[model samples]
Target chain A: MSPLHLCLALSAALFCTGLVAVLIRGNAILVLLGVELMLNAANLNFLAFWRFGPGGGEAGLVFVLFSIAVAAAEAAVGMALVIAVHRHLRSIRIADANRLKG
Target chain B: MTTLLAVLALICLAPAVAAVLVRNLIHSALLFVLAWLGLAAFYLALGAEFVAFAQALVYVGGVSMVALFAVLLTRPGRTDLLPPPSAARAVGGLAAVSLVASMLASSLFWSRLPSMEPTAPIPLRRLGELLAGPYLVAVLLVGLILTVALIGGLLLAAPRRPAEGADA
Candidate 1:
C-alpha cells in the first residue's frame, strides 16, 4: 500500500478501536480516553493529507493545532465532570449513573 | 519506509487495544500514554516535527496526567468491583463497531485519493506567521474557549459547602 493509504488505514483502525472502547467500557474515564483516541485519529488523517497532498499544507497544520488545543480543553472539562460525578455518586461506572431516568 | 510505517502503526494501535482491555484503570491510563507517544512517532515519520512535539506535550504530558488523576480520584480505595459488561451488550456493541469500521474501510479504499510525492516540511517560522497573521482570530477564540473551560472545570470539581442552617 502507498504511504497515504497506510496512514488512512491506521487512522480508521484507531478510530474503530476508540469507538469500541466508548461503546463497551463502563468507566467514564475510559470513555473519555476513547474520545481522545478518536480525536487523535482525525488529527492523523489531517497530517497525512497535508504531507501527501498538493499546496502549502498550512491549513491542515493549523487545523491540527487547533484540534489538539480543543482536545486538551475537552479532557480537562471531561475529567472534571467525571470527578464531580464520582463525588456525587461515589462511583464512576456509566451503568451506575442513572439519576435522570424518567 | 513501508516497514517503518507498519511498525509505527503497530506501536500506535497495540497500546490502545491493551488500554481498553486492561483490568486496572491506572494501567489503562498509562497504556494510553504509550499509544499517544506512538502517534507522535507517526507524526514525526510524516515530517511534521512541530505537531509531533505538540502531540507529545499535550497528550502524553497533559492529558495522561488528567486521566490518571481522574482515575485515582474516582477509585480511591476500592478496586474496580464492577462486573464485566453483560454478554449481550458486549456483542451488540462489538457488532455495531465492526459494521462501522467495515463501512469506513470500504469507502476509503474505493475513493480515488490524489497521491503525490511527499512535500518538504513547512518551516516553523512560516507556520508562526500563518497562525499570527491569518489564523489569529481562531487562536484568540481558542484561548477564550480554554479559559472558559478552565473556569468551568474548576467550578464543577470544587467541593460544595455544607448547609449552615442544617448544621446550626
Candidate 2:
C-alpha cells in the first residue's frame, strides 16, 4: 500500500473523530477543539497531496501556510466570542444561549 | 517509513479519542494539544520542516493556549463542563462519522494517484521567496486578517466598566 493512502486514511479518521466530538460534546470549547481537529485533518491532506502529486509541493506548502494563518485567526476570534457568550449568559454551553430564538 | 506513520497515527488519534471521551475540560483540551503535536509529526514525516514547525508554533503554542484560557476564564463555580451525550445521540454521531469515513476511503481507491518523488525538502528560503513573489497578495491579506483578528479579540474580551453599562 502507498504511504499516501495511509496518510489519507489517517486524515479521514481524524476528521471523523472530530465530527463525533462536535456532535456529541456540549461544551463550546470541546466543539472548538473538534473544529481544530477537522482543520488539522485538512492540513494533513494538503501536505500528503503535495508530496505525492506530480509537480513539486511548493504550492501546497504555501497553501498550508495560508491555512495555518487563517486557522490561528479563527481560533482567536472564536475563543473571544466564546468568552463574550459566557460573560453574557453565565455559561459556555452552546444550548444555554437561546435568547434570540423565536 | 510505514512504522513511523503508524506511530504518528497512534500519537495523533489516540489522544483525539481521549480528548473527546475525557470528562475534565482542561484534560480534554490538553489532549487536543497532544493530537496537534502528532499532526506536526505527520508534516515532518512528509519532509516539510517549515510547515511542521509552523504547525507546532501556531497550533501547539498559540491556539491550544487560547482554548485552555477560554476554558479557565469562563468557568467559575462547580458545574458541569461537559454534560454526557444521550445514548441515541452518541450512537447517531458514531454512525454518521463512520458513514463519511467509509465514503472518503472508498473514493480514494477510485482514482489513480501519482507516486511520491523522493525529492529534497523545500527550503525555507524558497518558501519565503514564493510568499513574497507569486503569493504576495495572499500573504498580505493573511497579515491584515490576523491583525484584525487580534484587535477584534481584544475588543470582545476586554472588561467593561460599570459606568458604561449604567444606562442599560
Candidate 3:
C-alpha cells in the first residue's frame, strides 16, 4: 500500500478506537484521553492530506501546530474541570454524576 | 520506508488501545504518553520536523504531566480504575466505531488521493514567517487563548480558603 493509504488506514483505526473509548469509559480522565486520541487522529489526517494533496503542505503544518496549541489549552481546562467535579462529587465516574441529568 | 511506517503505526496504535484497556489509571496515562510520542514520530515521518518536535514537547512533556497530576489529585480511596460498562453500552460503542471506520475506509478508497512527496523539508524560518505574516492573527489568538485557559485553570484548581470563623 502507498504511504498515504497506510496513514489514512492507521488514522481511521485510531479514531475508531478513540471513539469507542469515549463511548464506553466512565472515568472522566479516560474520556479526556479518548478525546486527545481523536484529536491526534484528526491531525494525522491533516498531515497525510498535506503530504499527498496537490499544491503545498505548509498549510497543514500550520494547522497542526495551531491544533497542538489549542489541544494543550483544552487539556488544561478539562483537567481543571475534572478536579473541580471530583471536589464537589467526591467521585470521578461519569455515570455517578447526574447533576445535569435534570 | 514501509518498515518505518509499520513501526510508527505500532507505536501509535498499540499503546492507544492498551491505554484504553488497562485498568490502572496511572498505567493508562503512561501508555498515552507513549502514544503521543508515536504521534510525534508520525509527524517526523511526514517530514514536518518542527511539528514533530513541538508535538513531543507539548503533548508528552506538558499535557501528560497535567493529566497525571489531575489523576493523583482526584484519586478515590478504593475506587476501580476500569469501571464496568453495561453490555448495551459496549455494543453501542462498538457499533458506532465500526460504522465510522467503514465510512472512513470507503471515503479513502473512493477518493483520488494525490501523492505529492515533499522534495525538501520545510524550513523553520519560513514557518515563522508564515506565522508572523498572514497567520499572525491566528498565532496571537492561540497565545491569548492559552493565557486565558491557564489563568482559568489555576483559579478553578486552587484550593478554596475556608472562612476563619466557619472553620473554627
Each model's fraction of native contacts: 0.81, 0.78, 0.75
TM of each candidate vs. truth: 0.94, 0.92, 0.93
Q: Is candidate 1 or candidate 3 better by TM-score?
A: 1
| Tens digits of lDDT, candidate 2, A1-102 | 677888888998899889988987877888988998999899888888788766666788789999999999999999998998998888887778878742
Count backbone clashes in candidate 3.
0
Per-residue accuracy of model 3 over A30-97 as CA lDDT, tens digit each: 89989989999989988887776665767887999999999999999999989988988888888777
Off by over 4 Å in 1: B80-82, B162-168
Each predicted complex: what DockQ?
A: 0.80, 0.74, 0.75
lDDT of 2 by residue, B1-168 (tens): 878888888888999999999988888999999999988988898899988999999999999999989998988467535668788878888888888988988888786776676456777888899999999999999999999999999888876655475565
User: Given the true complex, what DockQ would model 1 score?
Assistant: 0.80
Please give the clash total of every predicted structure, in order.
Answer: 0, 0, 0
Q: lDDT per residue, candidate 3, B64-160, as tens digits?
A: 9999999999986765466677899888888888888889989989987666664466789999999999899999999999999999998887768
Better of 1 and 2 by TM-score: 1
With a 3 Å backbone cut-off (N, CA, C), the pairs that clash in candidate 1 are: none
lDDT (CA) for every model shown?
0.90, 0.87, 0.87
